[model samples]
Target: MTRVSDPSAPRIAIVGATGAVGNTLIDLIEKRGFRYRDIHLVASARSAGTELNVDGESHPVRAVDEFDFSTVDLAFFSAGTEASRQWVPRATAAGAVVIDNTIAYRMDPDTPLVVPQVNAHELDRRPRSGVIANPNCSTIPLVRLLKGVEQRWGVRQAVVSTYQAASGLGHPGIDELKDASRAALDHPDETYPAKEFTPSLAFNVIPKIDRFLDSGFTLEEQKMLQESRKILGLPHLDVTTTCVRVPVVNGHSEAVWIETHGVVDRTELVEVLAGLPEVTVHDRESRHAFPTPATVDDPDRVHVGRVRVNPNNPRAFWLWLVADNLTIGAALNAIQIAEELVERRTL
Candidate 1:
């Protein structure tokens, strides 16, 4: 790593700096005024030489192959899984700790899969692998709420269905959706060729998010279960999910059914959810109570509503949540991990 005069404010590099999450990271860094000695933008060769502004300064994007990871103390990798698999080791080997925002190292024994609000303790010490893994976007919000419920009532099992937006696949997915939707409107009979989403996400919802496993669950679904278990330290946590791709452009929504060991009270449940850091809960009283992706005022927070206890079973409750997949699910989580590392002097 480059010798830093101020350890608290380390030089940082953003791999995949031209992608959706990378852009969100830049915006958050500016909005939150995250301190850093230097910032480097790195992306694929195709995006190299392009300029993107961060905190009012224009930074030319450098090709990842040409970027020197040794010049930075920390690197945030929001590139796809394959890119992360190929480059994360190089960054870590160069002595820069990596906050990987992909599924690549989440299950690795030495790399801690982190959701800052739920498992900031994991950042107290740097990992043996020299990398920290950001949990799945859908998994991030779920685990954040699960941590609170588990602590108060002891979770039994969680069943979730995610309404993920096109942005989960980044700009290409968004572009495809917009193109397909326009085509459908103009030519209702013709089919739009969809590369990002199967059967087109124009006016339909696809039940699968990622590749299907032998057991029939999509990889996205499995990520939620496995990542949740790892982050919450509940090795046998029974969290099953159905990951769906919806037509929306940005935020991801989840309908969660949580069965806890103890009886749950609605008022206290609302209080617990609302009390969590950066979470907003909408109770049943208001005229426009529940939060939707487009309607939610605060993008940084996890918005939850429709809290209902199963009448027959007091231990079971259901809730709906909306979170910005690019921010809360990706960029913000990675930034939070870095912030925790900085605060704990673990980097």
Candidate 2:
């Protein structure tokens, strides 16, 4: 890999500095050592002035309303959808590249939905609106792992069951689990459990992730369907997803079943996946190893395992995949896109 350097390096700002994804963004940016003239951390006025250490120095988080994008060259927006909806246009109008990690602008035909490993070149399109939208958390890893298969078998359809960690729903998700657990153990006689989740998440499972759409699928499930197609440039691809919230804290896992245009053997798919750098294949018999969150939790590599065809379906393949939704799904992809931009001389 060649090191990227920007002689006139531009200042990079991270919106939502106090959020989980925001903290991950700061770590990834410094770890890659990307060239930047300065680093600015911005957040809501409530979080402003909070002290955080960056590159060994302590800096205070600034208020979003006080930021002057005129001086920043790039900004990563991990704030909620409402904030992105309100501020993205202003930052873009000021000539600063905005990589938004929200549902607000992802479906817009004018904004390219990017997963660096899958549809990074989509960023080369130079959106008329000037913002690049990152895919939904669960969709990012799934799309990349499927990329190798799509190259050979040409995936036609998919069905995925997700075991999403509580963090996928943000702070409220975590708090709900904590509150429910506390109430259950402490106040056993209490009538109601925690109220953050629609369903009790302490010891139960949530089959629904987001709001239900007219098609009867949750918003998260539909995001997987639509975002995967857009990132893969396969508009007509069929996708069905069951997104669930699990008790796990950080990593996201999926069981994917894909029908391809041509026949594919399980071993052949494993071979192709093992060879991909971004993908880690864990199908060992002696050690009884198969990809899991414990193995591929924080790395950019997506772990793939349990490769097998449906017992009767010869034209399809089934597999297990895992990755850190925080790293590969959001922060790392954003950093990789910036690096690619510099490499392609398109930054």
Candidate RMSDs in order: 2.2, 2.5
| lDDT for model 2 | 0.81
Q: Highest lDDT, which number? A: 1
Please, what are the lDDT tens digits per residue for candidate 2 over residues 110-190? 888888877777766567777888788899988887788899888888999999887776666777777777777787777
- Per-prediction backbone clash count: 0, 0
Q: Which ranges of candidate 2 are over 4 A from the true structure? A: 1-6, 188-195, 284-287, 295-298
Per-residue C-alpha lDDT of model 1 across residues 168-259, encoded as one tens digit per residue: 99999999999999999999999998899998999999999989999999999999999999999999999999999999999999999999
What's model 1's overall lDDT?
0.93
Q: How high is each candidate's TM-score? A: 0.97, 0.93
- Point out the worst 10-residue segment of candidate 2 by lDDT: 1-10
lDDT of candidates 1 onward, in order: 0.93, 0.81
